[model samples]
Target chain A: MPKTKAVDLVVVGAGPAGMAAAVAAAEAGVEKIILLERQAELGGILPQCIHNGFGLRYFKEELTGPEYAHRFVQELKKHPGLKVKTETMVVTITPDRKVVTTSATEGLVCYQAGAVILAMGCRERPRGAINIPGTRPAGIYTAGSLQYLMNIEGFLPGRSAVILGSGDIGLIMARRLTLEGVRVKAVLELMPYSNGLNRNIVQCLEDFQIPLYLSHTVTEIFGEKRVEKVRVAPVDKDFKPIAEKGFDLSCDTLVLSVGLIPENELSLQIGVELDPATGGPVVDSFYQTTVEGIFACGNVALVHDLVDDVSTESALAGRAAAAYLKGEIKTKRWLPVKAGRNIRSIVPQRIVVGQTTPLYIRARYPERNATLHVGDGQTKQQVVSPGETIYYTLKPEDIRTADGWVEVSLEGGRVHD
Target chain B: MTELTCIVCPVGCRLKVEQGKEGLKIIGNGCRRGVAYARDEMTAPKRMLTAVVQVAGSERMLPVKTETAIPKAKIYAAMEEIKAITVSPPVMIGQVIKENLAESGVPLVATGTIAGEGCFKPLEKSLGSE
Candidate 1:
C-alpha cells in the first residue's frame, strides 16, 4: 500500500448501490467519500443491459439500463466531495473501516474511512454451481454473461438455444436471442409458476410463442466441443427429477438464469454478520452491519429485481454513514427483525433505536389477495410472487410503542420483522 | 366475462373484461393505464419490438426498436424484415434505419450508437459467425 487516503466514507462496487451510496453520503454533508468499482466503467452491469423497463420507480419514466445508471452517476458528479475510482478492485477490508484496492494505474491504494458501505451487489449463478450431468461444453453461459456478450460485446452466443430457469433474465434472453434470429426451443423452470414478473412472462415468452415447461429441470448436457443437445426432466412437487419423464431437446447452446448470490467476500473479510436467507450482511435500519461503522445495502443485502430499489436502499446507507461520521447515529440499543408467515427474508435484520426503516421482503411463493402483517399494521397486497421484492415500512413510533422486536409475516407466513 | 392480466406494470393487474349493453366494462384495475391496456388488448393488440441489427464496420450489433408500438398482427412480418436488414456505422440514436416496417408504418430506428471504422475490427475479420 502506498499512501493511505482517509475519508469519511468508503463504498465498494460502483453499481447502482455504490454510486447511490456515495452520492447520498456526500449530499448528507460528508466532505470526503470514495467509491471503488472493479469495472473499467462506473455504471457496472447497466452498460451491458440495453433493454428498457428500468427507472420506472426512481425516474418516473422508462429508461434503458445504461440510462438508469447514468442518472446516479450524473447525480454523484454534482457532489464535489465524492471521488469515483473505476477498475479499482477492493481486495480486502478490515473490521474497522479500512479498504484496500488495486488497479492497473494505481498499483495499490488504501482507504481508511470513518464508515464503510458494502454495496458489492450480486452475481448470476453459473453452470458449475448446479448439478447437470454432462460432458464439459463450450456453449454454456449464465444469462447475464450472455447478455453482456450480445449486447455490449455485440455478438451472438449461438444459433439455437435451450434456456433453463424461467427467471426474468432467462425470459429476457429468450426474447433477445429470438430477436437476433436465433431459435430458442423452450424455457424450463423448476417451479410451477415462472420466477419472473408476469409482464416479462407475457412479453418475452408469449409474444415469441416460446414454450415454458414448469416443474422441469435440465437433467444432462450432451456436447463436447460445442453444445449439441440437452436432456430435460419433469420434477415432482419436491423438485425430485423423474428420470422416466425425461425428454431430450436438441439445441446448440444452454443459458442458465437459475438464481443470484450476493458478492460478499469482502463483507465476510470485514467480519460483518451475514443473514443466511438473503446471503448478505445482517444490517440495521441505518444499513449498519454487525461490525459497527460498516454498512451494507443493495443486492448485497438482498436480490432486488429492480435497480431503482437498490438505489433507494443504498442512499439510506450513504446518509447513515454520514450520520455516523457526525456522531448522530445511535448504537446503544437495537430491536431484532424477524420474517414471518409467507415471507422468506427481511433486510435490516435489526432496527436501530428510534429510526424509520423500510423493510425489503421476498415471498415464499405465489399468492393472491395477500396481506403482509408487520407489527400491528397490515398491508394489502394485490398479488405476491417469490420473484418480486415486497416492502413494508416500520415507523419509529411504531417500534417505540411495541415490543423489543418487530415481526413481519405473510398470510401463510415466515417471520421477519 | 373474460379475465386478463394487465401487462402495463409489474403489478400485473388481473382485470375482468365483460361485454355489457354499454359495450365493455373493465374491473379489478389498479390504475387508469390498466383500463387503457385492457381496451386496446381486446380490440387491437400492439407491442414495441426491440432487437439487434448487425453492423458492417463494427463487430458490435446495433440495438434498434420500433419508434412506436406496432400492431400484433404484423410482428412476424416485422421480424422478418428486421432479420434481413443490416447496416453500417456510425449510426446515431433515433436515426431511422428502416421505414414502414411490415406495412405497420412504424419506423425502426437505432436506440444505441455504433462507432465507425477506426476502432472496430473489420466486419469480415470478426470472430463468431452464423
Candidate 2:
C-alpha cells in the first residue's frame, strides 16, 4: 500500500503540453504542483525531433524541437514551487481527481489534487491500426519510432525503404534517409493533397526526386522474415484501394506515418467526457472538462499540428486550472463551440458567456484565402483569411449578446474589401 | 499585373506584382523575405533538392541533397545530373556529389546514412540473366 500525497495541482506527462501547463499553473500562484513524466527525460518528443522549423510562431525564431523544449525546461527549473517527477507512469486517474502512478524507484504512489491537468499528449497511429495485409515483418516501423531509433538511438532502420503516408514525419524521414545514403523508393500519400506541410513536400520529397504517389496507399507488404517488397495502389475518393492499379516495388523497409491520435486513456479512466471528432476531451472555454476539477490540454485535448500551438494551449489550461483551484472562475452557462465546414474541431468546446478571452481553432483541411465567420447565425463577426489556424478575442459582453451555439464557417476564398 | 501569395508564413500575404519600366514593381509584401520572394517569383523561382544516388557495386542508393536552393529552371537539369551519378559505400555525411548541378555554384551535399550489412540487395542472378 502506498501513502497518498495531497497537492494543489497534478499534471501528467512532462511533454511540451505538460511542461507548459505545469509552469502556467505555478505562475498563477498555485503551490504544491506536481508534474509527472513517463520518460526518463522531461523534454518528451521534442528531444527526438532534431530538425528546425519549430517555435516560429511562439518564439518568433527558428529552433529545433529539442531547443524549443529546452527553453521550457529552463523556465521550469527556475520555479521552486513546481515538483517534477521523471520516469513516472500514471496508471489511472480517478473521477474525483486522484492519480495513481508507478515509478521505477518509487514503485507505486497515489496523489490527490484539487485540480488535475491532463496533458499526456498524443501517440502515432501504428501500422497495426491500418491493417495493411502483410506478413509480420521486422523492417516495418512507425515514423516516430523510427525517428527515435535513428536520431536518438543512433541506429539506421534500413538501407532501402518505401514510406507510406506523406505526413510530415514520413516526408522528413524520406529526406533523412536520402542523406544517410539510403534508398527511399517512394513516398505514397493516400490523399490528393498531402497531409504534411507544403514546405516539407518541397524540401523532403520533391527535392530528393522521391516519387510522390498521390491518391495512393500501401495495399500489401511482402516478406518472409523481413520487409522485401511492398504492393501499393491508387485509392479512390473514399480511400479504398483500386485493385487493378496495384504495383509491387522491391524494398527492405516500410515506414508508416498514418496519423496521430490523442492519448486520452487516463482521461477515459477518470470518466471525462470525450469529443469523437478530435478523439480528445470536451473542454470548455477555460480548457476545463465536464469533470469540475479536472482540466485537459495539448494533444490529450486535441492533436495540434504544431508543437508551438500545443504549448500555447497547454499554458492556458494550466493557468485556468490554477484559477479554478483559487475559485476565480464562476459561471453556469458554457456556450458550446461547434465546428463548421472545412473545420475539424475547436478546443474549449464551450465558452463561459462573460469571460473575455481569445478562442483558438485549427481547421481540419487547409483552405486558401478564406474568411472565418464566428458568432450566432443572425449576427456574425468575420475574420478574413482565417488560414489553417484562426484566433479571435471576444469580450464577455460580446458572447453574452449571442443566443446559443457559436458557429465557425469558411466564407469561400474571397478577399474582403 | 499578377498576384502571388507568400508561402513562407501562416500569414500568407498576397503580393501584387506589376511590370514596371525598370524591372518589376512589388506591393503588399509584409516583410523583407516577402519582398525577396516577390522578386524571385517574378524573375526566377528556385527550390532545394534532396534525392537518392545509386551506390556503385551495391544495390543501395545513398540519400543525397543540394546544400542550397537552385534556380527553378535548372531543377530538371539537376535531377538529370543526380540520376547519372553513383557513389561507393563508406560515404560520410556532408560528402559532396561528384558534380555540381546548380548553376548558382553550390554543390549537392550528402545528408547522412551509410551502407551496412544485411541491408537490401537486389537479387544478383537477375542482373546477369537480364
Backbone collisions counted per model: 15, 10
By summed lDDT, the worst window of 10 consecutive residues in model 2 chain A runs over A377-386
Give the per-residue lDDT of model 2 (tens digit) for B1-130. Answer: 9987664543556788999899888887778777887888778776555556666655545555566667877766776787777676666556787546746677976654344453342121011110
Which of the numbered candidates is closest to the native, going by highest TM-score?
A: 1
Highest DockQ: which candidate? 1
Question: Candidate 1 at residue A238, lDDT?
Answer: 92
Cα error of candidate 2 at position A311, Å: 1.3
For residue A164, model 2's alpha carbon misses the true position, in angstroms, by 1.1
Displacement of the residue B71 alpha carbon in candidate 2, Å: 12
Where does the lowest 10-residue lDDT sum fall in candidate 1 chain B? B121-130
lDDT of 1 by residue, A52-133 (tens): 7778778777667755765776687687777777767888899877788898878888888898889889999888788789
- Per-prediction share of native contacts kept: 0.27, 0.00
Candidate 2, residue A133: Cα displacement in angstroms equals 0.7
| Chain A TM-scores of all predicted models | 0.96, 0.93
